[model samples]
Target: MDSETTIREPRAADGGLDLSPVSRGRTPLLLRFTLFAIFFFPATMVIEPLGASGTVPTLLCLVLLLAWLASWLWGLHDPIPVRHPGRLAISLLLLASIASYAALYAGWTGGSTEMTRASADRWLLLLAASAALVLVTAEVIRTMADALQLVRALLAGAFFCCLVGVAQFVFRVNPMEWIQAAMPGFTYNGGDTPFQIRGSLMRVAGSTFHSIELGVVAAMLIPLSIWRSLTDPRGRRWFHWAQTALLVFAVTTTVSRSGILGLVVALLVFVPFLPRLVRRGLLLSAPFVVAGVFLIVPGFVGTIASALGADTSDPSIATRVNNYPRVVQLLDSHPILGSGPGNYTPPDALRILDNQYLGSLVTLGIVGLLATLAYFLLPGIAGVLAARAAVHPALRGLAGAVAAGALVAAVCSMTFDSLSFPVFALLYPALVGLAGGVWRMVRREADLRDDENAATARGAMMARAPAPTAKEVG
Candidate 1:
């Protein structure tokens, strides 16, 4: 059978792929669970027993990983794409973590290992959980239809987050606090309240713990949302575009310069892949979106302008500058594996290095840092390859969008301590995993098509050839 035929897919009234679960197969429970973990059990809510690393989303990810493990072990599904570069990179990253931890104990870090021991272990566990999330996502959702399902779920979660952010920034009402109040046992991790005001504008974090974090999350989602909107059937595109606009507007609510930068980066990565008409339409809409924001939020345009124009006097800028020397000095001491993860406590290390590359250099060190770079970048590179090779439009769109998200996540790290906030961390790997998976599917499609073509050629050659003569046969 041709690879384009999906047993579960059904056409929708809009003349596009129906996004309902029925169209994505009956047994994509892990995808559903992953979405549920994103929407209902946010990354902020931690159960007491599991400690700080035991946020509902994190634990749920760990659960999903275990479920995938059992299936793999029991031979319930196809074998994992073990040879994929992203998977290999993540494995290398984890191994690097183990090496770094051992190096710490070997007194290579030249510190009292006891002080950083437990913290380092916790970081290792978190890294493991992060790997689990990325791997399971890449393994489980293997088809275009299921990939669309994942996209829709992520869009919904991002949409919901944007709505909450809008309400917080504009309406002065926060529904997340209500959920927090009702769930007595669950406390928010990262004890930072994301409510701040800048020149009469409310800076809100939405489901994320910090406003800057929300900025990158919005930046990451905008591309995916745009891909969905543009690919959806004619009538439904507006709704998705509206969702994209909400994401854009939500970032403005944060009043963050990095948020603006993320938006710019996402657009730059995503826009080039669009068709001419779509690209023109997208470009033309920007002014209207800006006008809409200005009309709705009054000073939003000025607020965003002010944020973008912020100078070195801004504390975020000043602190980032100060970290350069500190990070360089630390790198001199333990350049290979540095100190183990979580050993860079704020007080002991002087201050947090918000840069992901720098912190990874200090904590995970050079070898682990290279592994970390591979883990973040390789999947997106694969997606770019897949997009170029893709025969199907859906696969092309998914690959492009996911690639944009991964690239955005990687660059966004330059601005802040990105993965420390589970929201960004969660979505980044999901994007990475989804990219890797989409690439595999595209490759499989190519392989299947080649086989079909080869068989057709053989049949045609046989048909064209004359039958053997009786004398010749004798």
Candidate 2:
């Protein structure tokens, strides 16, 4: 072909690159693959059908680590930016772990020989996952529009879990039995109490390993349902009502007082700015709560009466009250570093503390406990700030809801169980992402204001300045 006839290469100035197709096509595939790895690995490893632990969870984690490593490698061409807000805090946490390990190795009394390298791996994995998510997601999806997709994904994921949880309650089955069959070594601890006013109802755990895990799932969904009701188009308003119903149904079945309290706390956090949404959301949710009462109210009353009246002579409540002093006594012995990570004895383990913050101090010491609090509270503060300053109605609602959910769960989790489960682990990091996104939105608005001011200043200076004259110049 003649040189003149040859197709000319695109130039740098003319809308240089067309990455629309590439970006759009690649994103869904990558995200789907990542989610698959995340959900599959943890599910299978712990149970079986989900994987051994869960193929999806395992790969999702590994991929995130690999992505971070790749960013380091690419730094030779262009250095990556810092995105992790809790980097300093997380670093201190890791250092504490190492220092504790060394103290135990040298002469510390509370250290355990059973504390293997695997314990270190567990903490490191969480830090790695948190750090990686902040980095990869900041690049892959930077805009508010992009972040909303993540919010939607979170809502959809929670909804699926809630649906399954409700099904478990109605059907009295694990539902994900194929995966459970593969992991025969694991035990199912679910049980329904009878001889009460309420019918026997299965506590819905869904894909999670415990009923409390289901509660965490419920708490996260409540905010999204409220957000949808407020910001969604009028035509789509009914969808939010349906979601509210689902959340109430699932939450009631879990029969967790902590979870119920969490729902109330989450709503309270957002109600000041979103009273209309709050009112509507609650109205939609009330029926499901009532339905739950109808199904289990009699049984619940009997159970409560048995405990309050001491009719059954069960020591569960009394035993927990009795153990509080013992736990306090034990805390005095290892206030700084605790008994060491993974250092719980059978007695300590069997105590059933029902308190995450106390349990953390007992197991991992003050350092871990503080880190846990910081992790939960930081996003909440950031989220509240976002809600206060949000410009778009939809984004504001979503951020506010997520923030509220985190706050509720933080309070509820502290009283029920330590944040050791995968559900809590997963939700915290996701909330961190949402908070970071909100911060970016706020920052961008500030930048825009600054730009507008600068432009006005420039125009005013030009208008006021005298025009140069030839005679004056000469």
Top model number, TM-score: 1
Q: Estimate each model's TM-score.
A: 0.88, 0.76
After best superposition, candidate 1 residue 239: deviation in angstroms?
3.4
Top model number, lDDT: 1
What are the candidates' C-alpha RMSDs?
Answer: 4.5, 7.7
Model 1 ranges off by over 4 Å: 1-22, 78-82, 112-115, 188-190, 232-238, 348-350, 459-474
**Alpha-carbon local distance difference test for all models:** 0.74, 0.57
lDDT of 1 by residue, 1-474 (tens): 443344554432223333332343332666656664664455657786666677777777778778778887899876544446567767888888899899888887877366588777767767776777677667766655567667777888888888888878867787777776766788766554559887768889887777888888888888888887866432366788889888988877888777888788777876776667888998998898878877877777777776667777877667888998989898898899988876787773337788888888888889878987887788777777777787666667677778778777788788888867777777777777777677777767677667768978999999999999999899
lDDT of 1: 0.74
TM-score of candidate 2 against the unseen true structure: 0.76
Evaluate residue 10 in candidate 2 and report its C-alpha lDDT on the 0 to 100 scale. Answer: 33
lDDT per residue, candidate 2, 178-198, as tens digits?
A: 554665555433321211122
Separate clash counts for every candidate: 0, 31
